[model samples]
Target: MTVLILGGTSEAVALDQLLADQAPEIRAVVSLAGHTSDPKPLNLPVRVGGFGGIEGLRHYLIENRVVAVVDATHPFAAIMPFHAEAACKAENVPLIAIRRESWKPRPGDRWRSVPDISAAVETLGKPPRRVFLTVGRLELPAFADAPQHHYLVRVIEPIGDRLPLNGVKVIQQRGPFEADEEEDLMRREGIEILVSKNSGGPATVGKLTAARRLGLPVIMVERPPKPDVATVDHIDQVLPWLVAQGIFVTERGV
Candidate 1:
């Protein structure tokens, strides 16, 4: 059996590791979108770049003889799910989506949830005097319309490319940031507002806590919905489900 994982996020890495350890007999391949600087290395076969479109993906699946596809991509990765659904259907290949649940506002957390980035930008109301943008490099263009505000943008990789806005200050840094450091940065930069995607995980949750501590409002953009497919939130659940579906033999019985 051959399995292909549409990967990019940390969860994707975990899923890949789980699959390899539990089902070494099944060949696994992970496809990355090539948007990150230091993507986690996988022990399995890896492919980088888009599959062009639905037809292109169908061709790849057919050629590779991929029996199952696991869409373990970022929740915010909207288009890939649509393509995966279409391609898998056309090729008669089984598909599953592994998505992490979105984060919810806790007690004392000030959050304004928006459906999308454009809505988030509009919800900012008047231009904030100082803003912290943690939305990543791919979606930075959405803030171009809010050029009136001074933005302190943080990204994992250095952006050698020019941004559409001129009033932006770039901070090239990796994540897993500390809450204390996040608070200090916001204070020193005089940030009154925060703009971020509701990417639920602990590595980047420090900024949200920092914003809440300083009473700063966060314009949180909700993740895009996944396409029609069997989906699971945890690796253990997915492994059992896959075995039940005959994608792999149950380890205990086998």
Candidate 2:
């Protein structure tokens, strides 16, 4: 049974690496959304971009003979898994989600939870404060209502257009950033408030830690609800499932 991995997160990459090394005989392909300007290389053969929609995905699955699916998209990705679930159900193929757990507020963290990006902006209030905007480029526009605040946006690439905030500085960096680095950035930029989506993972939690140390209040956007489906938090758990499908043969080499 060929496995299709809906990839774009670290968990997806881990699963791909495991499959490449342990289940080489299993024909597996990773699918990337290609939203990032530059994404890291993965071990498995990857197909980039969307599959048109539910029908397009159904057609691709039927055409490629995909027997099973593993959905390991970013936590904030609310649409792709929905499409995967619909397509897999229609095709009668088993599907499982591999989601990384989100971050919980620690003892020192001063977190104010918001339902969405717009709510987070509202929580920031009328005062013009220097903000560390860690929610990503797509969510940046939500701050248009509060443009008086200075923003230090950390992104994989520049927005390449007019920013919603009048006072802004963009930092181009990739994870995993260290705690010391995060502290330095906050201090250098004189950030007073931290805004972030609780994208649960180790690769990008340094800002939260730094905020805690500096006693800065964080506007944490809660993660959206995920679709109901079989899910796993670890990579190795999928091996048994693959074996159950009679697909994890011991063929060597990638």
Q: Candidates' lDDT values, in order?
A: 0.85, 0.87
lDDT of 1 at 239: 73
Q: What TM-score does prediction 1 earn?
A: 0.92
* Worst lDDT 10-window in candidate 1: 158-167
Over 224-252, each residue of candidate 2 has an lDDT whose tens digit, in order, gives: 88889998888988987776766664444
Compose the digit string of candidate 1's lDDT tens values, residues 1-254. 57888998887888878877877888889999988857867878899999999999999998898988889888899899999999999989888888787888988788988999899778877745688989888777777777788889999877665356776899988778889999999999999999999988778899988998999988999988777788888767777766766878874853
Superposition-based RMSD of candidate 1 using all C-alpha atoms, in angstroms: 1.8
Q: List where candidate 2 sits over 4 angstroms from the true fold.
A: 162-164, 249-254
Q: What clash pairs does model 2 have?
A: 102-200
